[model samples]
Target: MHDFDWIYECAVIFYVVSLLGYFIDFLQNNRKANRFAFWLLSIVWVLQIIYFFVTLMQINRFPILTPYEGLYFVSWLIVTLSLLINWFSRIDFFVFFANIIGFIMMSVYVFSPETELLPFITETMTTELFFMHIAMAFLAYAAFTLAFVFSLMYFIQYEILKNKINFRRLGRFGSLPELEKMSLFFTMIGVPLLLISLIWGAIWGHLTLDTFFYFDAKVVTSIIVLMMYSFLLYMKIMKQEHGKKLALINIAAYLFLLINIFLSQSFSTFHWW
Candidate 1:
């Protein structure tokens, strides 16, 4: 058993309770329940942060290779995103959906076998730049996810308007202009972040590896994803494209981004999954 096994169990329990609270709010529109769930989720985030850092300190490397670690990280990201969205926007039911996703990830992690980091990776001559590269990449991913969520909100709002679905709560989603602007803003932020991450990754690669190729599956796919988003940004800003069509393009680009994630994982030479 891990030293922090109890912490992980507590986090899981809190996550389950938080999901139950969110479900209650979703069904009955209970603000108090929502607030309770929000705080519980916040606690879970704190626990996750504590556990992540403690493990990193113990392992002395980025220990995110195994399925359990991946699921935990994804779940934490979802909670973080959900909380940020709740704080920044008036989008209704987003928190509910986000927590649901987080819960599913956590459940799978719980059922999966516990595992350790790959020994060779931990023994690799990693530098601060390697950590920076990973950090920037994670930030870029978070920014892209935020953009995707906003773009998704745009579509949902558009459909509601188009269908004349008059659920009063639907008004909580920001207007199309707001959602679109937010999406663009986050994408702009993400593009530079990803570029910086790539730069750092390349530097670290050159420093540590015998042969560093830009054509590696992960790097190539990353560059392609970057270009796709860049093209979308240019189309929207330079060509003055807007509305549901642009949102659809943004959504499609994000889907491709998702594909790049799994595709690169499958074939990457140096990526630690």
Candidate 2:
């Protein structure tokens, strides 16, 4: 376990270095900085994978059963997805924002309660259904995090355009249409994944606890989050809404999700840390 901690700390250091590279790229539009960021993030990802498997071996199960572990996994997912996005889309700005979120999450994890193997594993948590439920749920949260970043960029670009601000100064931020497209694209992906996660969670609950739903605060807030994003997608598709309104909606939903994540553990029995 100490070895795993050491490796995890090393990965966090590399991630911070990568973030600095990205920040330099953002400020100066330097290609070398961008390349350094990509390479450094790649190294951090590999180290994190090592740390993940090591911790899993130590714990004798998945590493996401606790809040500390979950945050670490979520940060890993964010970085992995950001790398993929960068590889395919070459969207440097997207990668920047994504890693900014990743950096913040990793920083939080460094201060989070230390993760230790549980004294005993519960039968309910050991099942494949529960594992998939938790994994997919966290992945969905990661996707939503990306969507939030893109929506924020969209709003910033929108404001600049509406106020007739200097386009030259903000040109590196990417065009408004591109930002909007990415925002909607991520929302489309995250909503369906979240739905599937909820379905599997319900199935797991029914199989283990003989209950389809507990109506706990986490469960209720999760449903509301699902509905909120569903509405955002519906409005975009059916009502033909776009621009600031959609971006604002996405931001609002993300804020609510953050609240649910932080506060639900205190009040909800099912999802407590």
Candidate 2 wrongly placed segments (more than 4 Å):
115-121, 167-169, 210-213
Q: Which tens-of-lDDT digit does each residue in 1-273 have in candidate 2? A: 375688888888888888899888877778899899899999999998998898779767888877777888989999898899888875577788888888888888788767554454455576898888888888889989999988998898888888988755376667788888988998999998999988998887877774544678888999999999999999999999998999999999999989777788788866644
TM-score of each: 0.86, 0.93
Q: lDDT of model 1 at residue 40?
A: 94
Enumerate clash totals for all models, in the order shown: 0, 0
**Quality of model 1 by C-alpha lDDT:** 0.79
Query: Where is the poorest 10-residue window by lDDT in model 2?
Result: 115-124
What is the clash tally of candidate 2?
Answer: 0
lDDT per residue (tens digit) for residues 49-120 in model 1: 988898889776665545356567767787888898788777656677657757876777778876665556
Q: Report RMSD (Å) for each prediction in the order shown.
A: 2.7, 1.9
lDDT of each: 0.79, 0.84
